[model samples]
Target: MLKEILVHCGHSFCKQCIQKALGAQQQSKTPYSCPMCKLQLGPILELQKNFQLCSIVEAFLASTSKGQQQPGRLSRGRRAEKGVWG
Candidate 1:
């Protein structure tokens, strides 16, 4: 299951991925940065759970797994994923 978490840079990532990134950056003097945006942030990052996105991803996955059509809103989300923010 993908546990989506929101970082400071307004991008959502898996909690494990973010943890691995933070672990790799441990002991560094430079400030932590968002992997997606490269925005420098504080040493401690505040992670917020993206419940809406989690539901969306879960729904998408479930639909695909069942060979069913994706939800309508997922189409818009796909566009957003391709940098077409709306």
Candidate 2:
């Protein structure tokens, strides 16, 4: 799912993607920046998880999966093709 990480520039990204970017920056000894705006966001360690967005995501998933056999459980291997967050 869209695990939220709040960038200093007020942009949000999926936590996985942010972590990957941050890891890349660490290897390159560069500053972290918002992927969308390219605005410098300082250290990745300074960022905080956006709980509001996270709750929204959780709610959406819960609502969407209600009719399924296993509520809130996404089918494996079906997500990648749909680009859905699990």
Candidate 3:
């Protein structure tokens, strides 16, 4: 039996046992347990990075800055009325 591990789900099992369990699940409605260790496999931890999400935030800021070129217009004439020297 080949030992296999799924990093995303944090579960390790024998390859043959996993295959047989999958087959049984597909073939009929039956509860299957890990044959080697009998550990109830639950959801695995999904490793997610925030780099892509941060990039999206940065892109939104860039676009907003482009649209804010006319600053006084956005401020509703408040800066102009107050005689603010830009």
Candidate number with greatest lDDT: 1
lDDT of prediction 2: 0.78
TM-score of each: 0.69, 0.67, 0.29
**Candidate 3: pairs in clash:** 9-44
> What stretches of model 3 exceed 4 Å from their correct place?
29-86
Q: lDDT tens string, model 3, 1-86? A: 13343422334444565666656754675444344554544333222334445466577668767875544454536667878646
Every candidate's lDDT: 0.81, 0.78, 0.50
Give the candidate order by descending lDDT: 1, 2, 3
Tell me the tens digit of each residue's lDDT in model 2 across 1-86. Answer: 56788888788878888889888988998887777888887664676799888999898788658854465556665677678875
Model 1: pairs clashing at backbone N, Cα or C within 3 Å:
none
Best by TM-score: 1
lDDT of prediction 1: 0.81
**Evaluation by TM-score, superior candidate among 2 and 3:** 2
Question: Which pairs clash in model 2?
Answer: 1-86
**In model 3, what is the error at residue 9, expressed in angstroms?**
2.4
Mind giving the per-residue lDDT tens digits that candidate 1 earns over 34-62? Answer: 88888976877778899999999998898
